[model samples]
Target chain A: MRRLLLAGPDFSLAAVDPHSTPGFDGGKKKGAAALADGGEVLSSLQEKLFAESRAGSEIAVLLVLQGMDTSGKGGIVRHVVGLVDPQGVQHHAFKAPSEEERRHSFLWRIRHQLPRPGMIGVFDRSHYEDVLIHRVRGLSPAEEIEKRYGAIRRFEAEVAASGTRVLKVMLHIGRDEQKARLAERLERKDKYWKYNPGDVDERGYWDQYQEAYQRAVERTSTPEAPWFVVPAERKWYARLAVQRLLTATLEDMQLSWPRATFDVEAEKQRLAAT
Target chain B: MRRLLLAGPDFSLAAVDPHSTPGFDGGKKKGAAALADGGEVLSSLQEKLFAESRAGSEIAVLLVLQGMDTSGKGGIVRHVVGLVDPQGVQHHAFKAPSEEERRHSFLWRIRHQLPRPGMIGVFDRSHYEDVLIHRVRGLSPAEEIEKRYGAIRRFEAEVAASGTRVLKVMLHIGRDEQKARLAERLERKDKYWKYNPGDVDERGYWDQYQEAYQRAVERTSTPEAPWFVVPAERKWYARLAVQRLLTATLEDMQLSWPRATFDVEAEKQRLAAT
Candidate 1:
């Protein structure tokens, strides 16, 4: 699933069908079952990673999620990242920059939120926003936006070098799916809190956002930190694919429990006396 | 369950059986089933609380877990706190104070990690540690330890007044149970990472620790912020009780989705055009 979804050198967002489920021959029922099974694996693997950290291992995992507003980023967090122990998971959702945040470089806040040793850090909407939104809305000048692409590449490269496995994912959803999601939010009183006038306004630049995402992926995709553009028209498939991606990455780390720091036999004898 | 577990006047730790499942009649099977059912309720209440926060509601909930070694404090974090959306949860596990942390009063670190509006904050061990372990180990002078109890009362009072509900729970496990759990950790290779020689040493002071907990509860339990001494020998019952306590507290908050900040019809029309 990781290889199939990777935004490789030949990858193009325009050619990838948002409705297609690549490399998986399963319907919703099968996908849901597989996801449930994956949860056990994910949980076990995360524990080992956390245990390893206690022994001074610097290794960690960072899952960076970039997607349009309604493309199931929150759902992935609830379902996939939620499968692990909350203690080992550091979940952060980035909104528009605050006044203090604006005073620093874009990566300043991102750096501060990076997962520490033995944690799985998740970014609901990450540094990719500076490039995606800033490009689409002209929040920064074109040259400044161009420079962010290289900056992001170097920043991610540094993160990858520091013992953190970086998995960058873009939940690719079609224009119509986003409209349907927005419509549902507006139509349901229970969901009204999620509906925003800004979301409706952003829809007018659908093409521009897509183009910006494509460019960001093309410029920043690297061997150490590749982006996976998962088709998210089917929510179940998107969730399953991301879950598999995360599980596979952790499994590749080959984590093991740290050796006992104390003498087991001696400790057992001491405990018996107590 | 909340009323039964409350540390009211005349409440004594010795009177409570660590193995008994008070206010709950069922054993593990029934307890597990009810816990699964409660997960749905917890998730729903958490979402409403999260939604209300978006509309500028200052309301929040804090769950503080204090327990002996191997009393399943981490289990409550996994089973009960894990039942909700991770995005809405803020979990912090307090360890021994660091150089910087020691420079401030005991409550300084606690105040720094307080849950913000529309979130559920959890502390594995909190300010009460000053009175519990400090009293047990003589980490501070006797008068200094006595002062923390009053400081804690005022600190929690301020937190409660700031629209955050405080649910303080001590997972009470018997000495025999702790010994059994520690022995098991020694018996399993995978559990070795959790075994500490110090845990067995702490066992020698079990009676003193109990007296300290009793005094701490008597001094600090109040109308606005109360402590609940949960019998954690039965792990299933402890998880279920904590889950229910959280759900009941959130339900009492009467959270609703924030009313739409924008004109729904107008937003729908604007959405349809794009």
Candidate 2:
């Protein structure tokens, strides 16, 4: 069975430098059409997976999407997983912690949003923010921050044991790409509002964040909940990779239509009378 | 603005029961081709509306779906509102109250799920159930139930005053139609799993529930939140009515795109360097 994992950096032309290697050219070279086809396949497979989840009443899937500022997280969710049955899907977009969320353990909000049976839950940004944001801002003591890595792994393992399959993805984009993307947003009158001045300060810590992500990935990518390094220079490629991973995961589950027990003739008669 | 409500008996088969007025024959009859066309139009309109909501960052829309067992609430949500951007849309399916929910006010759970600016929130079964279920089950006194009608009106008024537009729909089907649907479920092997003997007991209270629902609708259908009586015998027609109602509500909001503020020349330079 193929394990489900998909992660990438957001290097969209709207947010990244057009000349960046992982930009449009990377996407085109990676076979954009093939990626789109993969997306279509994923959409078809998701329907069956959803029905099976409802019928078999088995495992749940958790898709973790993480990226830097202006990463195409919103766009990917909009275009890719948008086709799935909303009733069978739950989306949790993590934002800056509220007063209540901050008062609890870091995992409290995530624990509350965990998908129920027969549901696929998508986390826009997840627990890793504890490391990512805290590390960057020096919010937590170094020792405590390091300790969280093990905590996350154990928490995820417990979730896996309880019938939830976790897949985490890290979007990798270069500084040049980020600058270009930010520039585009600044240039476009319509998109200017999305360009936050503070992002430049964050850009200064880009390399540091990348190293941190790489270390986090190496440490936390376990058998129970693996992390995929998605090459996201190309939006199309990233989208396709995520879709393929999701499709393979569902296919591995070997979902089948549950057997129906209704008598067709009786139903036909009922329909006729109705 | 025209209010879109979905009020129909659970299942009223027109072919079997010629006396069924809840069937789609009264409105524009939607055949397969028309259904497909309407779906396309609805999909496009919903997409546009979602974009407008995200860009304008002002108005929010709430879709309230009420129906009996197997009334196609899930199907309608999957097919109709499925086209909107997930970032700008949220789906909340209310279930039996949890221990915590039972401890709080009836409106507590619902109050928390209200859509933020620039989003559409869908309620599979909403607050009206307090009146519908509690009345039918005799969980509350007649005086308390009457008081709830006022509470509902006030709650809706508060929401609407806060710039949230509510579209309440009551899916109406006839008893014979419901029987046909239930029989179809029982006859099909795959669908048999969905049938419960308890549903029949609930079906027995159909007239009483209808009276309760009628009273609730009559009392709570204020200018802020009007209810529409939708003929749900035809799934296609029901979907169209919902789409039309949604589009009209969005149009009433007068949405527009947010202004951008990027520097084009500098962005081009940044892109060229990337």
Candidate 3:
């Protein structure tokens, strides 16, 4: 499933069916139950990863999630990452750049959010947002947007070389699906707080967003930090798939509970006397 | 207990008995039990603080722990902070300043670690370390050290006005307690890694360190962000007291779980239909 979902050079947004469940065979109830199971297992692995970090193993994992509004970035954070020990997880939900952040290169704020050793860092929206939003909204010049892609690639490469595994996922949702979700937000008084009227303004440029995301993915998906385009129309499948992606990546690291540095028997005896 | 531990104009280092439990009524087992209870309550409050931040409230808490080696800052982090949801807790252990950090004023690195709204930020050693160590070692001129006291007060005042509650703790341990703990570190082969040879050199300046800490506390313990002097010879007592200190400050915030701004029933319907 990881191999299939990994975005390659020719990774096309057109090929993915937003509603498809891919390798998962579960319905909603089954998918949710599976997510709970994955979360518990992931929780323990995350603890070992954290323990190993304190034990001085330099390895860590980072998950980057990006998508349009109502695509469930918040849900993913609340569910998948939420399952891990919060101590082991560092979450950054990138909002608009601050004046200080804007004064620097786009990567300045990106660097601040990188996970420390023994952490599972999640970027609710990441450096990719800079490129996607800038290009779709004509915020940055095309030359600058193009330049950012390489900069981001170089940055991720540098981080990967420093012992952080990066997993980038683009929650893929269809136009109709997004419309339904937005309409739901508008219709529901409680979700009104979650709704942004500006979201509708961006929906008008849906094609550009898809194009921007495709180009960004095509340019930045490298072996060290490849992008995953998860079909997200099925909220259950999207959540489950991300949970599975995280599990697979950590499992591949083969992190173990770190060995105690002190002598257990002698210390036990001495402490007993004390 | 909060009233007693909080330092004021006459906060005397000579007066605070390092072995005294002060306000606490319990022994080790009792202190341990209270800490567990406080931790459980604090965890819930921290979650609400975090949720309120996510819900758009601008309040946070910062707990700064400072003391000599073997003073149990690490234990407090492991035991007290370990009780809270790791996600809601942001812990920063400050070391020597880097080239960039040294370029700025002492408070520069401190600004970087202030808890975001809804975060319980614990600084294992903080900006106060600059004044404490620099003064005791004569690393900085006396005038510079004097200037820093005012600087810290101002910086903390600014954060307080911005809605961050600051609680500074000095874990006061006796000379005998320090000697015993350090000796224990050397005697246990496993604890060898924790033993630092430099600690012995610092022990030589014990009188100067006490004087420096006293001056710093007396000058900077404002009502908005007061310093607490916790007796540390009794490790369990110190831990429980600090935990209590934190819980009291948070409870004072009176932060409520924000009512849902959006219509719950309508969003539920929309989500259900989707």
lDDT of each: 0.93, 0.70, 0.84
Model 1 misplaced regions, further than 4 Å:
none
On residues A192-250, what C-alpha lDDT tens digit does candidate 1 reach at each position? Answer: 98877898888889999999999999999998898999999999999999999999889
Q: Which stretches of candidate 3 lie over 4 Å from their true place?
A: A1-61, A70-91, A98-121, A135-155, A171-195, A200-220, A229-274, B8-60, B74-91, B99-105, B111-121, B141-151, B172-195, B203-215, B231-244, B256-274
Residue B108: error of model 2 in Å? 3.1
Tell me, by TM-score, which candidate is best: 1
DockQ, each predicted model: 0.84, 0.31, 0.10
TM-score of chain A of 1: 0.98
Question: Tens-digit lDDT track for model 3 on B1-274?
Answer: 8888889887899999999989877789988888877877887777778778877888999999999889999888866876676667788889889999999988888899889888999998999888889988877998998898898989999999999999999999987788789778756544565655567768778898899899989999999889999999999998898888888888999977666565656645544454
* i-RMSD per candidate, Å: 0.8, 4.9, 7.3
Q: How well is each residue in A1-274 modelled by candidate 2, as lDDT tens digits?
A: 1222322233222333322333224446565576656655665556655655656666778888888876667666866777676776788889889999999989899999898766778899999999887887898888888998999999999998988888786655667767777877766655655665567768767767876776677677887888876656667666766766677666666766565444556545544454
Give lDDT for model 2: 0.70
Per-prediction TM-score, please? 0.99, 0.80, 0.69
lDDT of 3 by residue, A1-274 (tens): 7777889888999899989988887799999888877877887687778777877888889999999899999778766776665556787888999999999999999999899998988888988878998998888999999899999989999999999999999999998889888877666444555665567668778899999988999999999999999999988889899998999989989977655465655554443343
Model 1 steric clash total: 0
Ranking of predictions according to DockQ: 1, 2, 3
- Candidate 1 lDDT (Cα, 0 to 1): 0.93
The regions of model 2 sitting more than 4 angstroms off are A1-58, A187-190, A255-274, B1-58, B260-274
Candidate 3 chain B — worst ten consecutive residues by lDDT sum? B265-274
Best-matching candidate per lDDT: 1
